[model samples]
Target: MSARGSVTAGRARSSSRDSILDSAGRLFGERGYSSVTVRDIASAAGVSAALVMKLYGSKEKLFAVAKPTEALLTDLDVPVSELGAALVFCVLMRRERGLREPWAMMPCTIQDTPRPEATRAKTRERYLAGTAGLMKDTTPDLRYASTVVALMTGFGEAVRTLGLFDGWDFDELVAHYAAIVQAQIDACQLAGQD
Candidate 1:
């Protein structure tokens, strides 16, 4: 191929890859890993099954690429006193920007996937442990960290997945919920000092 043709082909390939990843993420999020087949993802992506295989090699590989790997509350640069607002704002803004909430999909994955145990383990490792690690400076108790994770997950589900407070003013909602999260952190810190 000529230089120009090669560049065009590369762009087309990149587009196709992105489409495949988007479709895979949506399908896996909706139907869980085992329920979604390579062909299902390919059809959703508007590409042939052969192309998906050629690109990702297998359904598992595709899912690994498509799945959300980052923890929801990874940014801890803010002062510990302001962490709750920072974390809540980060999650809310991400949802507003249409980013996937991995925790929102946890219940479905645990119930629907072929390997529920694996899903549970991954969830604990990715979310619970990761969030707990961030909370270590505030509290040594894993239980407190776990509760914070649960609260955040439930709050995210309510706001994003269920649309519980759709019409509420964004700033008011953030402040209100941030207080609840902040209270938990405060309690954890107090307990740690004792």
Candidate 2:
């Protein structure tokens, strides 16, 4: 193939791969891991099951590929004080984009799968690491860190479930929720210093 044709083929392949991932993500989000199948994903993406396997190897690997864990982790890199706001903003942005809450899938994967234990464990560890990173303090109390993590995840889940952002100002809600999250982090920081 000519170089120009090769470039066009590469773009087409990239587009197909992305569409597959997008279909898989939507399916997994709508129906938990246990409920979704490779065939279902292939049908949703308008690809053959064999083709899906060829591209992603297995259902588990496809899920790992579909996950936005890296993007989620990057949200945790903001200033510790803005961590809560930034985290919540990330969730809201996903919803605004009509995408599923990627973090929410971790619990489902853990509860719903017997295989892929290592993948699930890695995801859990990453989530914990993100939580710990938000503390930004040496010797952070484990209990306090857990609370902050729970609050962050719970707030996001609740907003998604309740449609709390419906007809509301996104920025205002983010600031308000961030204050609550910051308060918890502040307490943790103070506790460590005492």
Candidate 3:
């Protein structure tokens, strides 16, 4: 083939790779880090498993670029109540839209190892910082803020598992989790309350 033809072919291959990563990102976010397999991602990307492996090295590597953890972490300028609203809206919508990975839990395979702990710690730090930006200043203490973030993540995962929000619209589900977390925060405010 001529030089021009070869250049065009190379561009096409590059485009295909970008497409593959886009699909993988969506899958990883929706299914969670562990649940999404290389095969699944490749199939979604319309590529072979070997290609996925060759291009990405591994799912974890692919995830690093495709589903960036830092993108979701943010400093909220609003109050805790508003912050909760934004989180429920974002995380749940992400789940519904296949953008937020539903699986953050450490799988049985990694249950005894420190491998998953590091990722979890990063997630925890990022998530809390985002949540804390809102509650940190107002709360008498930031201690419960960690609990609040944990509850939100865990409950959000459960809600996805139970499929309880299937028919319920996004706004409704956001309101629900927001209320639940708000209650927890409020309870924390009570001097004697645990």
Q: What are the runs in model 2 whose C-alpha is more than 4 Å off?
A: 1-70, 115-123, 137-141
How do the predictions measure up, each by TM-score? 0.58, 0.56, 0.47
Sequence-dependent TM-score of model 2: 0.56
Residue 84 lDDT in candidate 2: 70
Clashing pairs in 2: none
Clashes of each: 0, 0, 2
* Candidate 3 lDDT over residue span 1-194, tens digit each: 99999999899879878977887766654445666788888888888889888877887788778852212435233455465665565566466545543333323324555676876666656666655555553455556677777776576667665666678776677787788777755554563334
RMSD of each: 12.0, 12.1, 11.1
Candidate 1 lDDT by residue in tens digits, 54-170: 999998788778852233556354566876776676566556546776667677778798999988878776776666666553444477677777888788788778998789876
lDDT of 2 by residue, 1-194 (tens): 99999999899778778878988876664444566899999998888899899888999999877842224654345567776776677777677646677655556667677667877677656776667666754453466566766776677667777665677688898888888877878877787778
Please give the distance, in angstroms, between residue 105's alpha carbon in candidate 1 and its true position after superposition.
1.8
Off by over 4 Å in 1: 1-71, 137-141
- Better model by TM-score: candidate 1 vs candidate 2: 1
Candidate 3 total steric clashes: 2
